[model samples]
Target: MFQKVEYSGTKAQQYETLLFQVKALTDGEPNLIANLANASSLLNQFLNDINWVGFYLKDGDKDELVLGPFHGLPACVRIPFHKGVCGKAANTKTTQRIANVHEFPGHIACDAASNSEIVIPLISNGELIGVLDIDSPKFERFDDEDQHFLEKLVNILENTIN
Candidate 1:
């Protein structure tokens, strides 16, 4: 049996709580895939107005991202570096928050209902590991605060992954 947590307080506060949950979840996990899978599940449970949540892991031998565990409709399995939101985040080592996926140049439509998106680059020890991607059906669903907290969440991920 498990206890359900009701996320309360300001958006930032709720996000902080989520971060703590992430740390707790990955505290001693050394398996990368398991951690990423759980992280995506946590995001799907915590977030609203979203159509997709998942990871795009960097394929070390290739210049591309391979889809990891996800919670949503089927998605593009591989994204070339710099090709789309996930790719841009991987290529630039920066977060990509798109207010309107339709307007973004070369946007990849994994789910046609996703209007907005945010991608956080996952780097461990100065090496690019992958990215955490979240999508929303409504435009501008992600704000600056969301980006800040999600980045912090990724920070926790970078440290926990082996």
Candidate 2:
């Protein structure tokens, strides 16, 4: 059975539990679909006020990202590597966190309700495979703490998915 907990836990505690769940969900499982789905759910649970939690998988030959497992409103199914926050993150292989979506160059407003976003590139064996993207409706909704937490969380996925 799945047990629920208040979101009052410390960041480290929450992350630890999240990682444990990830391990539980992916252990001995080799399906990418299942892995990404569990990852999305884990993020949605750990973060606060997030409108979107999901991944944009890279299409190597096409140089684009396609929406993968996600928890939120419908999103852009395909985005060029040069467009939007997810694209930029994949292009630069760097995480991008924007306090205001309007200020982000080439911001693709799939959901008008989203105001802030953070995209963490997913790399395996030093090759970029996808991005873990999160969106919020509140401005300045994410901070350095979020960056640090997600980065660490992504590290946990590296071994499971890579």
Candidate 3:
């Protein structure tokens, strides 16, 4: 049974609690789409100052990403490698935390309201699985702490999917 938790502590502490919840939510779930859906829901409800949260899975037949579960406005369905923040993350297999989307080169605006964004690549067993993308209306919404904890959360997702 799942119950809502009202976390009370430092930001790091809250993230720790979130990580535990993710493990619980995904521990026995073998379906990748289902797990990603739950993960997106958890992040949507947990984070603030964010307009979007979602996942982009690597297309099995090509070098591009396809949209997955998300909690927010409709997003771009496909992104080629190195095209946007999500693309860059997937192509480079690294996390991209952008303070301002307007300043980013080759930025793709699925939503005009978003000012900041973060993308974390999900690699499993040395293979690119996808990426976790979050967008915020506020500038510099994601920092080092967010990057660190979100990556931890992604690890949980990766473990279940792969």
Candidate 4:
């Protein structure tokens, strides 16, 4: 059973709490899909000003990202590796935090309402797993703090999913 987070204190402290909660929710679960689902749900519950949160898994032997579990409106099903923000994150194996999606060239507008975006590459055992993608409607909605915490979140997922 999952309990809603009563986040108090600084954003970093809140995220630290969130990370612990995620660990609790996903601990001892060996199923990847189940873990990802619950992690997305947890993020949706904890985050603010976000319209979408989900994963784009790397299709085996393919150069594209396929939509996995997500929380939000329907999203684009497939994003090529060289295409948008999600693609860039997957390609570079790094985090991409965009303040304004419109300003990002070749940005795939899965949802027009999303103005800002963050994507963290999920890697395990030197293999690319997928990406954790979050979107918000407000410009500059995410900052360094968000990136740091989300990276921690992704690290938790990567450690547990396998």
The most accurate candidate by lDDT is 3
List RMSD in Å for every model shown. 1.1, 1.5, 1.2, 1.0
Candidate that beats the other on lDDT, 1 or 2, i.e. the better one:
1
Q: Residues 1-162, candidate 4: write the lDDT tens digits.
A: 556767899988889888998899789998888889988998999999999999999999898999999999999999999999999999999899999999999999989999999999999998889999999999999999899889988888898855
Residues 1-162 of candidate 2: C-alpha lDDT, one tens digit per residue: 655556547877777777777878888887777888888987777778899999989887688998899999999999999999999999999999999999998999999999999999999888888999999999999899888878877776777774
What is the lDDT, from 0 to 100, of the residue 8 in candidate 4?
Answer: 96
Question: What TM-score goes with each of the models?
Answer: 0.96, 0.92, 0.96, 0.96
Ranking by lDDT: 3, 4, 1, 2
Give the alpha carbon lDDT tens digit for every residue of 57-140 in model 3: 999968899999999998899999869999999989999999999999999999999999999999889899999999999999
The parts of candidate 1 lying over 4 Å away from their true place are none
Predicted candidate 1, C-alpha RMSD: 1.1
TM-score-best of 1 and 4? 4
**Candidate 1 residue-wise lDDT, 45-158, digit = tens:** 899899999998989878799999899999999999969889999999999999999999999998889999999999988888999999999999999999989999989889
Pick out the ten consecutive residues of candidate 2 with the lowest summed lDDT: 1-10
Cα lDDT for residue 22, candidate 3: 84
Pairwise TM-score winner, candidates 1 and 2: 1
Ranking the candidates on TM-score from highest down gives 4, 3, 1, 2
lDDT of each: 0.91, 0.87, 0.93, 0.92
